[model samples]
Target: MAVITMIEAQKRSGRFNIYVDGHYAFPVSDSVLVDFRLYKGMEIDKELEGRLTAADDVAKAYNRALDYLSHQLRTEKEVQDKLTTLEIPEDTIEQTLKKLRDFSLVDDAHYAASYVRTMMHTGDKGPRVIRQHLRQKGVGEKVIDDALVLFTPAEQLAVGTAVAQKLAKRYQHNSTRNREQKMRQGLMTRGFGGDAIKAMLDAVDLTPDVDEQHALLAKQGEKLWHRYRALSESERQYKTKQALYRKGFKLDDISQWLADFGESVD
Candidate 1:
């Protein structure tokens, strides 16, 4: 209980200069204090309790970040995004990522593999689409390629089937030409192989008992394909030349597929 002597309380420009034990104490920034009476000596407890509370708050925030990351695998970008969302400072994020990396908790390689596995099973995606997705997730090219190696031919078939089924359902229309063009573009956009798509297209019976528009379009497309397919050897060669380009087929593959159509190859 120290007696704080207020020796000279000078009324300054906009505040009262508070002196305790003939020495300047903390500033009384509030103007309301001027209304009060101050004598020669006053008692003040200068106990700094805020220091302890501030330290505890800082520690608690860091601990929360650590606990949040312990739950699952996270990419470096994902972890950094989360850290930013949590309002953690950049320095703290660097520290947290380092700590996480040391623990083998935030490895991009492991995360990429797990992501590929999950996407393969539920997302029903091919290598190209999955690679793009992983790239957006901040995975490196080598890691993406490593993950892609796991996609076997059987997996590619499943992915192709999934995308083809979905697209075939939507692109069925009154105009068979429109439906055919839309499906070719759609399946290609979904990263399915042309051969795989051709097989799927051939296998699906577009005509069903459900709707007349679908049956009509299916008949029209079938009629056109048959007409185009049954042309004289020269006419067939001319149209086959354009089919590959229309299909977005690779130049090498296109040249190879139509080699016998109008080529000098014996």
Candidate 2:
């Protein structure tokens, strides 16, 4: 048994240093100080000392968790991982999570729903990518599924069409077929499913005007012509034909462009 010699306030707010028998024993937050009712000349037995330290540990861990949640809404797993990094004991971390859940401060369902809603209204991410993101954040599959109901087929089509249209513009210099292909690929990469991709393709108009197609072909063909310049004339024309064909130009269109190109060069 030891007797409390002093109870001194710490430089940090709401913390106190406990001294027992003229030697520093432990430090505790103000809440713990009040709960344990420690004062000078108070007798401290082994059990009481253990209780005070254990309670102080919990208090500190809880406070840390509250501060962590203050900046933004966090997943329970995120909070648990954070407390674990601080070297808080597993039981203490569990207790802190329970306290947060009890206060409705950390809820995976609410987080999942809010995330899905935000993505549906303002983001270009498809349902699959959103689900993957939520999974990585440690949200359960069931919660993600429930949340995804907010992203209906109509909403998916609307967003996918908008994204596909933007991608088509990026590939506008290519042939219409090539632009459609690139837009499909971009939609796929953005997590749109095949059905949604097909719908988006149908919705977007990739066909350039006849004059625009000729101009685009000329712009692309000239680069290939310059690229194979060191080869023999026959070899350069052959290579240019193959390159432009692979770039989604029709055979007839390639022939016309080549004839026009030959005339321009001569």
Candidate 3:
């Protein structure tokens, strides 16, 4: 048993240093001091002291969680992980989590839904990538699934078409097929599924005009012609044709370009 000798306020507000028998014992928040009704000359047993400190721990953990959530909405796992990093005891962490949930301050479902809505409005990530990011944040699969329902097929098409159109413009210098292929890859990278990407590709106009196509093919064919210059003429022509074919140029186009290239060289 020990007797309280002093209750002194710490430099930080709302916290106090507890002294027992003329020696510093532990520190607690103002709320804990009030709840436990500690004062100088009050007698306390070790068990009661344990309970007071435990309550203080819960208060600290809960306050820290509130501060963390002040920046943005946080999942329950995020708050739990934050408390764990502070070295809060597991039971204390659990208690803090309960208090937060009781107040509706920390909820995974709310976090996931808000995150998806925010991304849907302002982000380029596809549903799969968004799910991956939410999962990494420790949101549950079911919560993520429910939240992603807000990202409807209609939304996907709208966003994907916009993205695909932008990609087609970026790849406009390539042949029609090559530009379409690049747009497809770009859409996929941005998280659109195959069907969504295909629809978006179909919806966007990637076909270059005849003059643009000819110029693009000629530019690429010239580079290839130079690249294979070291090879025998037959091998060079064969290599150029194969390279242009792989780049989405038709065989007839390749043959005509090669013939025109040879004539121009002569």
Which pairs, if any, clash in model 3? none
As for candidate 1, its clashing pairs are 4-42, 5-21, 6-40
Q: What is the TM-score of each candidate against the true structure?
A: 0.51, 0.85, 0.90
Q: What C-alpha lDDT values do all the predictions have?
A: 0.61, 0.88, 0.87
What would the per-residue lDDT of candidate 1 be over residues 67-169, giving only the tens digit for each residue? 7767876678877887788887776677667766787877898888888788778875667778888888898999989987877767777766776677777
Best prediction by TM-score: 3
- Encode model 3's per-residue lDDT on 1-74: one tens digit a residue: 78999999999999999999999999999989988888999998899999998999999998899899999888
- Any idea what lDDT model 3 has? 0.87
Model 3 residue 188 CA deviation (Å) reads: 1.8
Candidate 3 lDDT for residue 3: 98
Candidate 1 overall Cα lDDT vs. reference?
A: 0.61
Model 1 alpha-carbon miss at residue 258, Å:
35
Tell me the spans in candidate 2 whose CA falls farther than 4 Å from its real position.
1-11, 17-24, 33-44, 262-266
Q: Candidate 1 at residue 62, lDDT?
A: 44
